[model samples]
Target: MELNQRKGKVMIEQTLEDALSEVYLQISPNILESFPKFRPPVDLYIYDQAVAQVKKFHRAEARLGTEKQAVVATFARENLLFLLRDDYRVYAEHLSRKLGLVLVEDDFKAREVSEIFFIAFRDRMDVFLSQPKIEPFKELLRDVSILAEYLWTDPCRVEFLTKTLHKEYDLSVHSVNTMFIGLGLFVMASGARPERMEVVNLALGLILHDLGMTNVPKFITDKTQYLVWRDRGSIENHINAGLKKLERLEINDPTVRQCMSQHHERLDGSGYPEGLRADSMSMAGRLCAVADSFSAIIGDRPYHSSKVFNEAAGTLIADKGRYEPALTRLLVGLLKEGFPGCVGEDMN
Candidate 1:
């Protein structure tokens, strides 16, 4: 009878998990605001490992009353928790508050909040890749604006953002990393506050700099052997391909075009497509170049093993004239202060 009861409990738990998966979203309790003037209509659930079941901590209306303290404390103490997916806007607002507070308190909860942001950003990017539509791209631009504002205010959130980078090598993940790291480097190096529009434009450019790579044949990208001129030519053509696609999308921003066109170009005129020298390259182009190179180097590829952050930063710095000296130094500084050391290995 005890064995039967155990089996029945397991089945019930599985059913609960499945049912909740549809209506609820798992959330880190760290971002929950202990008190808010406006609490959204949403139920909160905490999974009790002792009983192996999820239990409602508080109903939607209860959160508006004095029971709020209890709800926050209980959720913060629990390991597994869920919130109504319908109330995501409330959660986003809560995250915004937490992000601002974490910076003031010199707290680590920034990682928790930013990790959620990163996941959502990556999901949006995935949709854009599959659809490649104007709406999705516009939504991505909105995210870029938020990120730029975040960095513009603190500039140090780059450290927390780095911790959230998905070590897995994919176009979406790489693009996101480049955007975050590039914007961080740009903000850090600029000293004086940058215009909001400049930051947004650069952010968008960094994220889409490799958009052309989607047009290349997978076999060429995945090739393990030496590439002939034809193969190299095909790979290098991604710039034009990405630019053409953007043009079709009606994206006429010169900053965006510069990033897509010049990220591969070296300061010493050793790059492809256009062999533009240092004097000809824009700062946005240089910023994207360093960011693209660093993000790619630290991530594993079909052709090469991933380099550690220190090694990758050193490699870029060692290249001397290939990359801009000031930007490489900024990259090094960012790594020294922010890099968590382990990457592409244990990062899940």
Candidate 2:
């Protein structure tokens, strides 16, 4: 499939170069103009075209090699519609069962997988918050490591990845942005002797910090109205549960533990769990706290829509000693500079 725009009109073409050297108009410029408003069923047209083209070119092939071509022809004819509709995921699973070449999304290419994993981690946060299971949490941690390595090695990939998984959910999007922001701060602050492993650990911890809520019921988690005292208590348990789960994983790294454990802890000894003061918290933990809080304030939640970046920054700064003031200022500055588009009021 290829997309090109000519004379201010977009064209999408599908090409099949097997036994049947087939080419088809998957989408015309007219159809492209209606996208995100009126999505036409061009995938069906592509499927029909593939079938007709294959039959026109390779109906008499009978040998083993030809048999393989027939199989490819059949797959293209039968699955083209599904593939175009983002249903390749379903077909890939079916093909995997038969030990065939499972089709993978181009957006999920090796260079893009890290970003996809990051987005998936955020999407799975609701599950993690509700179920708080061990295995899924571990998987989330693995994704964190993957994304960190990708970001550290190829910073440019982050922009491409972010552009690809453009989700409507604000919280999930905010989580990805926060991970980048936090990691950037870590890299910048560490100066000459940046500990790469520590950065990865911090990323994992920051990404999955909300995993403990999986045990909470939906009524409590999704409550739009003010949560009752009991519901609030249950919600608060997520933080402790997240820490306990991390401990069970035997993550002895203090930076990782503190990032998860003290993200909610305030500098004024008013925070939860231990209520540790400024001296008690690790630098990583303090950074995570600022990142998490700032991200959350500017993110759409079940209770309230997201605030503008300036508004969220002001709120964070107002909290003052409750959070790391300097770090909060740095985060606010980063958001302003790096993601001017993020602070807008529009949900999309």
Candidate 3:
């Protein structure tokens, strides 16, 4: 029975890998080069990052205890790779309501080759985060997953991306840049402790703390006029807008809560609707505030030209009481070093 169980696991692993290899091979370098915005599914990325061998990811999963093992299984079932179907008729009939992914008649699926098609999700999690309570948090995880995939293989690009990010200030672009900046700066701020959870949670919170913006009208976000009292009120309301979005979700993670509620606040009792001071603002909030302002300064806006890395760093430093001093120091040092010359995780 043990042997059979092992064989079953291996079979599932091999079958999934075989399908992915076919997809990867079918999407040749030429094909991939054609789509400049193309990003691999998370499964393929994790597999690639774990080791060249297909067996390694499964082994990592297999080694997990029961609780974590179940989580992996849940992830697999809800993964985008598993959701793509030529017909997906049953899915269209049943799952279209529950899922928020791309679904169409096989012919309409991909704008590219009909023979080889793909479908991903703005929110791919069909089951794992389907609960009313679990769904709000999924966007944070989804964005973080995309950022991780981009970082896991192309660490050099992560360092260089801030320059490009300065030219565009879309919400998603800003969030991605913030995740990388905050993760890197937080490591420098904390003296580079090896505790993985600190960086992970910080990355997630920084990326999604602006979730409330999705509800705010684009006109307000894009306005050319100086923000009046009502406009500022609308902007400040986003903090609670974000909190309300996550209120149904049963998140035990305090970082998520702090980021959702406090990203706009300052240390000098001068920020936003609440006017929270240094004592009230949590460490996560303070660190994220620095990253948020840094990215915003570097990012382009209708009102002002984008600042270079040094100029952006100076803006953060000059705003003394608004941000934590030690974090600002680390951030300045990080900008000077240009992120340790693009240090990266080894595949080994």
Candidate 4:
């Protein structure tokens, strides 16, 4: 009877999970493993799983009042990972006692995961990395946008966003890192009062920039053989392929489409598919290009190991006609401050 009852409970949970998925358009497979990353955050596990991980978090937070805070406290208490911001590095005695959640600040480092996720993200890509296809991670982004939004404000988020971009790097990690970087650049470059929607779009665009790479066969992505120029040419088709794939979803924003399409186009007319020159590129395109290049070179990959920041910076600057000279320099500058948000302000 006990066994039957346990089975009944498991069955009920599975059914609920399925029903919740159908109701929410923004879905993620790592819902259970990740935190309640949505804005203002959510209280209950059910709401966190169904709403917090989706666009609905913004809506749900409005209707939820005091209970939401209590629930957030509960969720934070349950998940012990600390996300202390600089201001909160040392907590007051009273506040620490009152708040059950941990608030780690100042000192945290990269760690690995069995999957592409961690309770907190890290920069260490040695044996700690996971190489999954692009599709799953892209799908997971919607669920984690809230988390990504709040990462800059906390230490874990900063650590997660600063991870290296290797050849076999996890798609989700690289996308989120690029999103933060590109968004950071936009926020700084756009002005003291940049448009909020622009920040959102740039983040979304960078995260999904390489989404089409999932279409590439694993054999090719994992190809151990040295390829001739022709084989390499076919491999580079991911950018155009992504544009077409995203088009099928009927994405309404041209900015995102344009950003993705032109991310690889060189300023010197040396880039792929449609070799656009520097004069032809928009500020957004240039930002994404620099961000993508920086992210790609700083991580370890199956094809090649990660490059040091100085080495990568030198390469970008020296590679004439490949990247915007000024933007390349800014990317290098970003590394100095641990690549935090509000970089543009500092640059200015």
Candidate topping lDDT: 1
Candidate 2's C-alpha lDDT?
A: 0.53
lDDT of 1 by residue, 1-348 (tens): 012222322344667766665556554445554335345346776656557656776676553555765655555544355676556545654554333433333222345546656765677778887777899997887767776666667555556676566667888889888887887687677765677788888888988999999888989988999999999999999999999989988998999999999999999999978999999998888888999999999878898888888798899999989999998887787767643332321222
- List model 3 lDDT by residue over 241-342, tens digit each: 777766745454789778767777899988865889999999998888888888888878777778887888888789878988888887777666655645
In order, the Cα lDDT scores of the candidates are 0.72, 0.53, 0.53, 0.50
- Candidate 3: segments with Cα more than 4 A from true spot: 1-166, 339-348
- Segments in model 2 whose C-alpha atoms lie over 4 Å from true places: 1-117, 123-138, 155-178, 191-194, 339-348
- Where is model 2 poorest over a 10-residue stretch in terms of lDDT? 3-12
Give one digit per residue, the lDDT tens place, for model 4 in 1-348. Answer: 012222211233556545543432111112212333443222233233322232222232344455664544443343311222221212222122222122222122221110132222222211122433345434443433433444434323333344433334666566656665666555445434444455556666776777667666666766667976766676678887777766765555766776788888898898866889988887778888888887777666677788886687778888887887877776666566544443221110
lDDT of 3 at 108: 19
Best by TM-score: 1
Q: Give the clashing residue pairs of candidate 3, or none.
A: none
Ranking by TM-score: 1, 2, 3, 4
Model 2 / residue 83 / CA error / Å: 12
RMSD of each: 11.4, 10.5, 13.7, 15.5
Tens-digit per-residue lDDT, 222-285, candidate 2: 7888889999889888878877777776766777777778888889999877889999988887
Number of clashing pairs per prediction, in order = 0, 8, 0, 6
